[model samples]
Target: MLHIVACIKQVPDTKIIKMNPKTNTMDRASAPAILNPYDAHAVEEAVRIKKRYGGIVSVLTMGPPPAVKAIKKCIEIGADEGYMISDRRFAGADTLATSYALTKALDKIQKIKPVDLILCGKMTIDGDTGQVGPGIARRLDIPPLTSVKKVEAVNQEEGHIIVHRKIEDGYEVIQSSLPCLLSVEKEINEVPYSSFPNMVKAARYEPHIWSVDELEDVNIKQLGLKGSPTIVAKVWAPPKPEGGKIFEGTPKDQVDQILSVILEKNELFQAKGGY
Candidate 1:
């Protein structure tokens, strides 16, 4: 049976997030916690794959206990199983440290049932770094395919999967062996509304929660802030742009005014080759 693993996250709603200047951290209380948008798409894709291929779709996340909500969200989306790695030691982890912790959990899960494929979102909206997925792949020693736009095929018997990976101009088709990692773009799939049965099942579903101690062969130093090398020295919002000048006049007059303004910035236009 194909066992697909999706790495998901519970991130604060980016729309209402605020920074804590004093600690260089996010003001978690400022915004309601929600499933990461990109990860939701990953979960949807995994569920679709499960439906098509007849396998188990498992979702995993690393966050505090409240992150159980995110796991439930995956269940509602049709994931068969959910796992969460939550512990005080995992708090304040940067992408690298977070990846380390996640890989450990994945290793344990793998012993229980070998995973055929791993999926992740392109990036988390809260972090926006887009590094953790590839990081996990590196730690797991698997091929990393980022920004996947479509899943072309998953040949389990042949042990390979074909995908369209997004590139600068358009996309590139990739065929990687099974057990590879895929970081998917949001355009890959649309998450559909949950049916009544799924909702009811999700309401009663409980994810397998693991603490740092529960994870095998874990390095104490690599689980949290202690292992993070990149430090946020400060967190602050950038200055908002000034409002544009509104010229109120006839169409011809407005055109003349715009021309005058452009003339004043002719040097900038020339420098940017916008002339």
Candidate 2:
């Protein structure tokens, strides 16, 4: 059976998010969280592939225990199993740190069932950096394909997958070897409705959680903020422009006054150029 693994993330719903005036960081507790919208499409595509190819679908996520909500979402989407890697050591991770942690989890997953394919959303809304997918492929020494819009075929024996990748203006058809990672565009697939049984399973699902100790050759220094090369040096919201003072007048008087001001400002039209 084909083993398709999709990586998903839990993110703060930024629509209503408030920012700290002093620190300029999101007030996470004030905002409700949701499964990343882009990852939803990726999960749907993976489930679709699993249904057609007759394989088990698994999901992997590296986040806090609260992030298990995203894993359950995958269960509702038809994944057979969900794995979550969570540790306090993984806090304050940037793309690089996050990639390291996720790669460690990927290594763990590979030990059980050699993953045939790996899928990810185009990018996370919060981070907006799509580096993790390619980073995983590089770490695993496999091909990484990005912005994929369609999956043409997958041949297990040949160990290759054919796909259409989003390009500058259109798309490019490309082929890559199996055990490949793909970052997919939102147009890849439509999310299907959850059946009663799957919904029930999703509601009760408890994901397999792994800590730093379980992964192989994991460098503790590289797992979270400590391992990250990039740091958020500082963040501040743009100062809101002071509200403009509106001159109140009738339409005709307002128009006349506006034109008079403009004419007076122009030296050529003003009677006296100075004063």
lDDT tens string, model 1, 143-169? 999999999999999999999999999
TM-score leader: 1
- Against the reference, the lDDT scores of all candidates come to 0.93, 0.87
TM-score of each: 0.92, 0.86
Number of colliding residue pairs in each model = 0, 0
Give stretches of model 1 more than 4 Å off. Answer: 19-25, 249-253, 266-275
In model 2, state the lDDT of residue 92. Answer: 84
